[model samples]
Target chain A: MSFSIDQILRGDIPRVERPPAADPSLVPVRLRVNGQDHDLQLEPRVSLLDALREFIGLTGTKKGCNQGACGACTVLVEGERVNSCLTFAIMHQGKDITTIEGLGTPDALHPLQAAFIEHDGYQCGYCTPGQICSAVAMLKEVEHGDASHVTSDLMATDVQLTDEEIRERMSGNVCRCGAYLGIVDSIRAVYEQQKGQ
Target chain B: MRAFTYTQATDASAALHAALQNPEAKYIGGGTNLVDLMREEVERPNEVIDINALPFSQIEVLPDGGVRLGALARNSHTANHPLVRQRYPVLAQAMLSAASPQLRNLATNAGNLLQRTRCYYFYDTTAPCNKRQPGSGCAAIHGVNRIHAILGTSEQCIATHPSDMAVALAALEAVVQVQGANGTRRIAMEEFHRLPGDHPEQDTTLGRDELITSIDLPALPSTANSLYFKVRERPSFAFALVSVAAVLELEGEQIKNVRLALGGVAHKPWRARTAEEALLGKPATAENFRQAAEAELQTAIAYEHNAFKIELAKRTIVRALLTLAERQLLA
Candidate 1:
């Protein structure tokens, strides 16, 4: 279900040849998901979350709202976390994608995964994957000195990762089970460990 | 969702050509809004043109002491860009106060400017919404419309523009660079988005076949004391209930210059030109700020559930201006 640039453009190598009006409903999309490339023939309207969960057989990413309102479908695309439900599968051509499945294994867990378990970060576990993925990116953002909405001084070059900052940054992923305290503790543990390392 | 054809365009002209080829085709940059609408069946495009690869992601410094921002630049990137953060802190704060970080990372400058309203009726296809389908009666007129517009609304629609960035742009007087079938032209941000007078279906002044290539911001050095204050139902990931973007310049005690624009109140960004005019040479005091807010909101017409917005908008404006004035004192 994958097509080269030529097959997509429907002509010679360089010039783009518009495909005829035959079977334009489905497009051949190639996705690199969780360190694996998957060739999926999908409808143009299929979301990236659907392509990952249904097409690629990866169900780690949860679909809470199926809209961008909730961060349940968060996934790292090209090292940046984005809402998978809000983007088309065909848009991500050759980008690096990392899902919750790629985060850790049963025997060996990522620090965030271990901290979540220790801190009891999940009561229902529906938003754990998105929470972990978003926390991973949030750490990188803090390391890069990216300020959050709660950051008082916009001109400050250095931003310390406070509890308020973590809460504000992780506000996208809503845990309906009221496990916010546990989630905050888990993220803080990981941040502290990263700084120590 | 309905099936559609998809194609990727590497340049701006190619994307415009594809859009011209199919009248029902839509150019998708981040797809944060359009993709959701397509899933809800509110928007059914026969073709979707991918324009993410266009070289419109750079933040350029114009020779005439201005900034030119490419259309494809992500919201997070633009908000955090050194030039924007330093020169236009209000714009940065506005963008930061918008949707979640993940969305801001994916939403582009042009897409943010062109995002549709988040009215529940507008998103619910089963409900009657003239913005979603022209000639369809507006359900928000009598339905649960706590989030409906209170200013610049017509009988046809009460939907408000949902972009926090647009409010700041309107206050800063940014210009939109559009490339259409005819040619390239620049549209002032003030005149770029139109009010829902008779036709609520048409959102912005962007033509059906036009592509927004970039946005140009004229230098406002006095806007160093600018800020964006947003009040939402929740702290994050929610649209503004009443947001204000204010820029203040003070000479000793009197106000030298001021700019004000409001969100969640109208079909477009409600620029407080009257407020700015009233506070031009007035003293930088809370009383003057309140008077300016009242002067700008004189023509406001609020619906049943949204009458509180008039008072809320006025308080937010005064608060924003007073905060900026206090910052000037501290500086």
Candidate 2:
């Protein structure tokens, strides 16, 4: 019952491509997911989110709005953040991708995850995965001298992970359950801990 | 979404060749807008030519003290480029104030400029929208058009181009460079966009076969201070109800050069040419800005539900100019 972007667009079941039309049909795509390489055979239209959940069995990335409006499908592609639902599996053939699955495990939680646990960042927990992934990506983006809307000094040499900075950068992710306070607090805690470390 | 053939084009010529090969082929960049249209069943392409792998992702300085931004350069990358931040701060600020980080990361420079309108009727299949289905009859003409245009509109369409980045680019005199089947051509930023006069379906001046290669921006002088002021319902991830991109250069106490652009008020990113002409060499006072804005918007016509736009647009322009001039006075 999954939707292919083409089926919805065409309003019918799209004809399967001719064997020669797609070279190396459904070939295993090699991707560096979560700092590790993965080889998965997928249909040409499979999105990165589906490829991870169906092929690799990482269901941490939730699907709230299949469109990019809700950030439930956020992921890091080559150190930059992107909406995973809009990306094709084949397009990311040899690129590095980091999903919520790669962030941390139960046995060893990442600093952000620990902060969320400490500060209670989630109420319904549906948007937590996307929020955490977006948080992780924003941290790296800020460190790299990328400026946010609230970043007044565009040429600032050093970047501080301020609360306002994190909020502005992480505005893509939503907490529908109304856990914004705790979520921002969790991210701030992580930012403080990372600075201390 | 339906199943379609996907081809990755590694260069501009290859992209054009592939596009020419199929009438149903559509170029794909970040897929932020295209995928949304697909999910809504508004756009259907038999084959999608992926342009993400193309060599169109660089933002660099051009030879003549100008800036050259590639088509595939992500919004995040373009908004934060050092040269853009320094020379065209309004463009940088406008881009930063656009959709949030994740969406911006996946939206390209060209795609942002070429984005379709967010009109409700166009998105809703049941409603009659000329932009979505030309000659279907526009329901928004007398229907709910609070977000529709007030200038450069027609009986057929009143949809507005919804790009904060383009609004600022228009004021900066940015030029769009495209490669087509015939050859490469440069379109001035002001002419790149088209108003929804008789043809509501036509979006830009670009031909169907054209692929925008890069955007060229003229050198902005240091004293020509600029700012992008956006008035939205929310502080984040919301389209502007009214936005102003103003770049003004002052000589002592009088205006030397002025460029004013308005968003969310016109069918395209409207360059306030009339207002600019009126304000040049005049004292950079609040009253002069108000007069200039009024003269520019005198021809503006509003729909039933959006008449506030005329006044709102005027206020936005005056406020943005005054703020820029005030900063100088304080300094």
Model 2 CA deviation exceeding 4 Å by range: A1-30, A35-41
Model 1 lDDT tens row, B122-221: 8766678888889989988987778889888899999999999999999999999998878999999989998998899998888987889999999887
Clashing residue pairs for model 1: none
Residue B185 in candidate 2, Cα distance off native in Å: 0.8
- Candidate 1 chain A, run of 10 with poorest lDDT: A11-20
Q: lDDT per residue, candidate 2, B171-214, as tens digits? A: 99999999888898999999989999888898899998899999
Candidate lDDT (C-alpha), each:
0.88, 0.86
For model 2, how many clashes? 9
List, residue by residue over A1-197, the lDDT tens digit for candidate 1.
Answer: 22343442332222221333455466688999878889888877778998999999899998878778779999999888999999998899799999999999889899999999999999999999999999999899888878788888878868888899999999889898989999999999999998999
Best by DockQ: 2
In angstroms, how far off is A37's CA in candidate 2?
4.5
Residue pairs with backbone atoms closer than 3 Å in model 2 (clashes): A4-B1, A5-B1, A5-B2, A6-B1, A6-B2, A7-B1, A7-B2, A8-B1, A8-B2
Candidate 1 Cα deviation (angstroms), residue B328: 0.4
DockQ of each: 0.31, 0.38
- Local error of candidate 2 at B208, Å? 1.6
TM-score against truth, every candidate: 0.94, 0.93
